[model samples]
Target: MPDDFAPTPTTLTTADGLSLEAQWAVPLKHRAKVVVAHPHPQHGGNMHSLVVSTLFAHLIGSDCAVLRFNFRGVGRSEGEHDFGEGEQLDVRAAVDSLAQSGDAQCPLVLAGWSFGADLALTCDAPELAGWFLVAPPLRVLGDERFKAAPDPRPKWLAIPERDQFNPPDQAQVAIADWTNAEIHPISGADHFLVGRTDKLNALIDSFLSAL
Candidate 1:
C-alpha cells in the first residue's frame, strides 16, 4: 500500500542529544518504516521541502511507515552542517534508532533528493533495500562509489530532462555503473520538478511496487 498515503509530523533525538524534527506517517497497520533524507540543509532544505514532502506522502499508505527528518542544523535539528560528513552519521543514527527499537527486515528504503542523494550514497548499510536518488550532482558525489555500489540493493535515479543542475547527457555518464538502477527522465521540469506532484507520486508508487 505505497500509494494513496498520508503524513504525520514527529520528533526524534540524535546521539549527540540534539532534537531532530520529522514527518512520521504509517499505514493503518504497522508496515516497513522508511528513513528519508533531505537535501542540503544550508540550501534551505528540510523535511517539508517540496519534493521530499511529496515523496513521503507517496510512501505512507497501507503497507509502510515513512520518516522524513531534518538533517543536522536544519529547522529544529540542533548543530550546524557537517558538509555531509556528520550528515551521513545523522542518517545512520536515524536508521539505528529504528532498527534497535525493533524494526528489522522491513524493506528499509533510503531516499533523498539532490544533495541528499549525494550524501546517501556514502552510507554502508547492508539492510538498506534500495537507494532512491533524484538530481544527484556528480561532482558532489566525488567518486565512483555510487557507480560501483553492489546490486543486491537496487538504485533509482530520477532526473528531470530540463534540469539546469543535472541534464540528461551528464546523468547518463554518472549512472554508468548501476546494474539495476533506472533513471526516469521527466519532461519540462527543473531540478525540483516544479508543478509535477502527480507524476512524482506515480514514480514513487512504481518504486515501492518493485520492492
Candidate 2:
C-alpha cells in the first residue's frame, strides 16, 4: 500500500490493433523490470490471478518495477482469445509497455503462470533478459513453438511435483535439451500450487537476485 508500490491502471495496444487492459507499478528505484502474464483466459485467468498478483506484490519494490495485465480477451481488454497464437502479440505488447514505463537499461524479465508460462517460452524478444515459468503445462502449443528453449538467456522453471498437467518428471523430459534453463521443483504442489506460493516466491527471489 505504500506510494512507491501503488499500481497505475493503464492500457496497451497490441500490434494487430487491440487495446489490452493493464496495470503497472514502479518503485523509487529499481534494478529490473518485469511483465507478468496470467494463466489461461478461457479458464478464468486474468491479471489478478493469485500467482500473477503474487509476482506483482513481491516484485514491485526498491529492486523491481512490475506490470501485470489481462490477455486480449480476459478482462476489459479488447479482442478474443487466440489460444496460444495471437496471445504472443499480447505478451509482446506487455513487454513494450513495461519497457517504455520503466528503466530501459534495467533487465527485462517475463514471469508467467500455467498457460502464461507456455506463452513466455514462445516470446523471443531481444529485450528479454530472462524468464521465470511457474507450473507450465507445456502442452498448450507444441515443442516447435517454444522459441526460448534454444535461447541462451537465463530461464527458470518451477515445476510442481504433483502437477496434474505437467509433473516434474514430464517437465524434465520436455526441457532436456534446453540451453541455460533450470527447473526447481515445488514438492507436494499440484498444478494449482494451493499452498506452495512461499516456495514459488522464494524461487522468484533467487531468480531476481541472480539477474
Which candidate has the highest TM-score of all? 2
* Error in Å for residue 170 of model 2: 0.7
Model 1, range 1-211, lDDT digits (tens) per residue?
A: 3432456566777677767776676554555666778777778888888888777766664366777888888887788887876776777766665554334656777777888888777775766778777777755556754532556577877788888887877888766765777778877777888897567678766776788
User: Which residue runs of candidate 1 sit more than 4 Å off their true CA positions?
Assistant: 1-9, 15-17, 28-31, 100-105, 144-148
For each candidate, what is the lDDT?
0.72, 0.90
> Which TM-score value belongs to model 1?
0.84
Q: List, residue by residue over 1-211, the lDDT tens digit for candidate 2.
A: 6787788998999999999999999877788898999999988999999889877887875478998889988889998999999999999999888887767788999989999999999998998999999999998999999999999999999998999998888888989999999989999899888888888878888898898
Cα misplacement distance, residue 13 of candidate 1 (Å): 3.9
Residue-pair clash count for candidate 2: 0
Kindly report which residue stretches of model 2 are placed more than 4 angstroms away from their true locations once superposed: none
How close is every model to the real structure, measured as TM-score? 0.84, 0.96
- Each candidate's root-mean-square deviation in Å? 3.3, 1.1
Please give the distance, in angstroms, between residue 88's alpha carbon in candidate 2 and its true position after superposition: 0.5
- Spell out the clash pairs found in candidate 1: none
Per-candidate clashes, comma-separated: 0, 0
